[model samples]
Target chain A: MSTQIPKNLKYTKEHEWILIEGDTATVGITDFAQSALGDIVFCETPEVGTELAQGKTFGVVESIKSVSDLYSPVSGTVIEKNSDVEGSPEKINSNAYESWLIKVKVKNPGEISQLMTAEAYDQFCQTSA
Target chain B: MTLRTSLYQKHVDLKAKIVDFAGWDMPVQYTSVKDETLAVRKKVGVFDVSHMGEFFAEGPDAIKFIDSLVTNDIASAAMGKAIYSPLCRENGTVVDDLIVYKLAEQKLLICVNASNIQKDFEWMNAHAGKYDVRFTNKSEHYSLLALQGPESEGILKKFIPNLPSLEYYSVWESGQTIIARTGYTGEDGFEIFGSHEYIGKLWDQLIAAGVTPCGLASRDVLRLEVCYPLYGHELNDEITPLDAALAWTVKLNKTSFIGKTALTDYKPKYKLVKLLVEKAIPREGYHVVDENDGVIGVVTSGTMSVVLNQGVAFARISSDKFSKGQNYFIDIRQKKYPATLVTKPFVQGGHK
Candidate 1:
């Protein structure tokens, strides 16, 4: 079953969710992504000062079953990292959107246009399934 | 194009993730390996081990015939008792490690790995010409299930009324089913052997009684936690039972047997050691390196442990290369990560 995606957020084809509010965008994995990964055992996040390009793998999330890379949705500098997620990665499986991994300061706000809308992402997941 | 077991439909019905392992379609996991591992440790869980092979040996000289093949003393085993033994070649190399259950003086049951079933049967039958014993490969006709955990006894007692009274490493036959209080997992469990037709019903009965259905993923982690030697990992054709630290099972005091001469003259150059990596997870085929960045050995089985929450691996390293508390490096994709050699069973005594 497909999970409900927030209408205001943008999504990536790699199953990452981006919540843009002003110059800073919060990024986390989708609920569908966490369920597919099973229990989250460990997470490796990029450094706070590291700069990432859009569609580039910045970190990795390892669950009990498999390990998946987390791709950056917008090209920017990572301003904040989730310390809570580093300690207890299982929080991502419980609430993916609330447990944001990184908050990146947007370098070019126009890059958000490349992400799919909520309706588009829902249809994309359906077709892929 | 791998062989599927009889419980293939049941596994698919439970939404299990299936994978091809050693030429058999097996369930890797049903929900999560971590949760299933914890369940078996604290409560109860059941596994579908029908892919394993079972054989029956009968006749007057069954004990004599089997004693000559395996490294263990099968003649000393009383009826209703089981002993783990290794079948070796003339060159002191292990063919397969098996559990031989003595049902009576003339009847014995042997459980072997699925991949080596045919070869092991051929080896046993070839040597049966002198003895009155006859070997039969009953793998296709039997299904094996393991009910393991601390609460396994309570759950199993509901079906088999006398199950809780049976001692460890003992076998009791109930009609067509053979119930043995032994399992690969380091827990208080029982391995039930019976026909495939009745196993589905038994599985449903256990599920109805609140026993969780676990898959091979959890089974591997459970066995690893106890430092049990797997076939491809710790035991292989080139490695002798003595080299793998399984010399306790080998009875060299006995009379002539296969590999006895070579085993007496053999001196192991390398030994198996459990390596614990901090922060860095070592995987299978990963090179084990020394302080000078010289490769010494390779990792056989590795995984991110749920209990330890770190990377644990079992590797065969040069005996004189490293000692306890000596640090080494594992080349994980060109990055040399730090690791240390520790004793087997990263986790200490729970059950065996």
Candidate 2:
């Protein structure tokens, strides 16, 4: 199935995506990630004010079939979590990018250079599949 | 490496996510578990259950032979009728739970779990040698499809006109297909048994007839919603039917059976109960704890229920510790979530 991957976003090997604007990065799962996980039943995200290092576990995304760990793409402190997900986790299934889990203040702005671009991530997914 | 069923190609064509289940390459989901599960509950859904085993027993002593093997009274089951029974070891421990269909006075058909095909066949054969019965394993030769839902009867009536008349737990042969009003999912459905080659056409016909294709992931959730006991979870060699709350099928009056002696002395120590978690999804092997934070038992099978839209689980808890309306806790990861002990089925989606 074809999934939407915004060109402006950066992705991680773990399938999480970050949309960086200034010092804050909006975090959510990629379309490829949501489709792979199937229906999202529950999402356990890191609380606000929680500090996370690059490549560190930030939360968990659980579907009917399996549970996957959500990794932070960039080092940051969690500033906000999506309260909509707390009420309706299925929002992630509908539009994964729009259903951002957390907004974090980027610890190191240059660290975004290490993340893969949308095209690269799409190619990575194809190779892995 | 595990074996693949004939429908493996169909799963791939549908872009289903395939996973290794009980040493078999099976489709975990086709579209989505939520959609497929809702389809089964509302309309109709077809499933590829060919990985399950089918065995044929026929001869002069067929009835006598099967009666000795299972815990249910096969002699009372009329021709064209099917009964669910448990095959127990000498110690009253459940080896496997199977469905036995009486085809004729001298012939019977047995359906067993996919993983226990080889072992079940060997066990049945060893016991058949002492009697005038013939056992034939036809699991590979046949393919089974389950069409289930409230509207399943309507879809099936388009092909077989008299399908509605077939009573529950009864089997009828219509051409090459043996249609049985039985299914694993707690819904009114038919289990069609036919040759491997023709089964594909039947699946296509059902799809053309508007039956959604379902996979193992939805099937597991559907069964869990109805509180149906799975083989490895609710049953095992160390657990008895009495403990699993399936004593209704065990005929204690039977003079001879594999587990008769042990069953006579069996007492319930642990009982399987259904739990509805308020916040978390309790998975298999998760600890079931009491209100005092003492571990009592472990969860056997659990999933995010589609019908209830909540987490449901079946766990074997101490009989003394289990009580109605009592709140229990399930340890998911490191967090303890409150769960409640309810009736067998967490949801009543018309499986009465």
Docking class of predicted structure 2:
medium
DockQ of each: 0.39, 0.76
lDDT of 2 by residue, B1-352 (tens): 8888887898898888899988999988888999999999999999999999999899999999999999999998788999999999898888899999887899888999998999899988889988898899999898999989999888888876776477878888766667888998888888999988888887878988878999999999999999889999988878899888798989999889999999988888788988999787888899999778888889999999988888999999988887666778999877889888887578776643
Per-model chain A TM: 0.97, 0.96
B279 Cα displacement, candidate 1 (Å) = 3.3
- Model 2 chain B: worst 10 consecutive residues (lDDT sum): B343-352
Among these predictions, the greatest lDDT belongs to 2
Model 2 CA deviation exceeding 4 Å by range? A108-110, B162-164, B174-176, B319-326
- Alpha carbon deviation, residue B158, candidate 1 (Å): 1.6
